[model samples]
Target chain A: AQSVTQLDSHVSVSEGTPVLLRCNYSSSYSPSLFWYVQHPNKGLQLLLKYTSAATLVKGINGFEAEFKKSETSFHLTKPSAHMSDAAEYFCVVILSGSARQLTFGSGTQLTVLP
Target chain B: GAGVSQSPRYKVAKRGQDVALRCDPISGHVSLFWYQQALGQGPEFLTYFQNEAQLDKSGLPSDRFFAERPEGSVSTLKIQRTQQEDSAVYLCASSNRDRGDHQPQHFGDGTRLSIL
Candidate 1:
């Protein structure tokens, strides 16, 4: 029953401003977490992943996330927002054990205004 | 062939009609997966395949939904007697590692299915 909760359903930011999309996960054990972005009519793209190697994980396109065990959070952050960053973001967790299934949160739609 | 490729970018079918969606995973990838994404929602796992053997299909919604990957390469998801509820984007993904590995799954532009 591992799952992720996206705190915001929609987040709007002006261009060049910082971006934050909150995600909290529920897992019985140490989990594998990932952030994916989907553009209009495009496939889901992997932005980054956390596999316990490091608490702070960096992803493509100047994006990064921190895996905070104490807070049960894996929030995605970026120093600045770009118009191209407008899309739907999903926080995902890999099912524990051999199932390897992915449990996704109810996604957050990011709108970057220029 | 650079990434996972799905056929029929869009599909429109009448209620009770049957539709088949295809997925071609990355070459040499040992694992393949199928997912269903409703409008304004995240993608949900529908099934998994390990080299043509369907190891986990627990996420499939019902018996009317079926998937196959013969020879461990291209996979297909078939929906019989499609209902309006079944209208959604069917996504296909592939990974180049074994089960339990942390290798990220690469996704294909999903096939959007609409049932009237």
Candidate 2:
């Protein structure tokens, strides 16, 4: 079984400032990690994933996350935040040989202030 | 050409009424997933299917919740004996069964079930 924890329920950032959303996971084996963003009343959008290929993964909309195995963390970051970036972000994890079933974190709502 | 889609974006059902939510995966997607999201919470895995075979249903709340992906393309989630506790957003996602690669999943807008 796999589980994920999002450190913050909400994060506030200023436009053009750096943004960070923290996430942690617990898995028995090598875990597949992902980030997704959801707009209000809209579907989820896959931001990026880390699948043991690279320690650092880059995603769309100028977002990226770094996987730290020792820390059991996959924190989402972006150098500059935009107004459109205000949305709900989720951190997900899938265990090995789990048929791709995912465990999602509680999600972090980002508020981009102008 | 289209992404994953879910029908009946919003549903209002009586406490005892039943409801069905639909999901259409992307073109040629073989793996589909269902999840339940409560208010202000993350999505919890409900079930998973690979080409019409339900391989994992560990997260389903009860027997009243049933899902099927007949013919391996379109899927439906049927909830019987709905209750106030069952009011939440149901999400569907699909991914390609790619080997040795990070196969990203595409998600649908989700069906919001409101039981009154």
* Predicted model with the maximum DockQ: 1
lDDT of 1 by residue, B1-116 (tens): 89999999999999999999999999999999899999999999999999989999999999999999988999999999999999999999999986948889999999999999
- What is the lDDT, from 0 to 100, of the residue A22 in candidate 2? 100
Using Cα atoms, each model's DockQ against the true complex is: 0.82, 0.69
Q: Which stretches of candidate 2 lie over 4 Å from their true place?
A: B98-101
Give the per-residue Cα lDDT of candidate 1 at B25: 94
* Backbone clash total, candidate 1: 0
TM-score of 2: 0.95
Interface RMSD of each: 1.1, 2.2
> Can you tell me which runs of candidate 1 are displaced by over 4 Å?
none
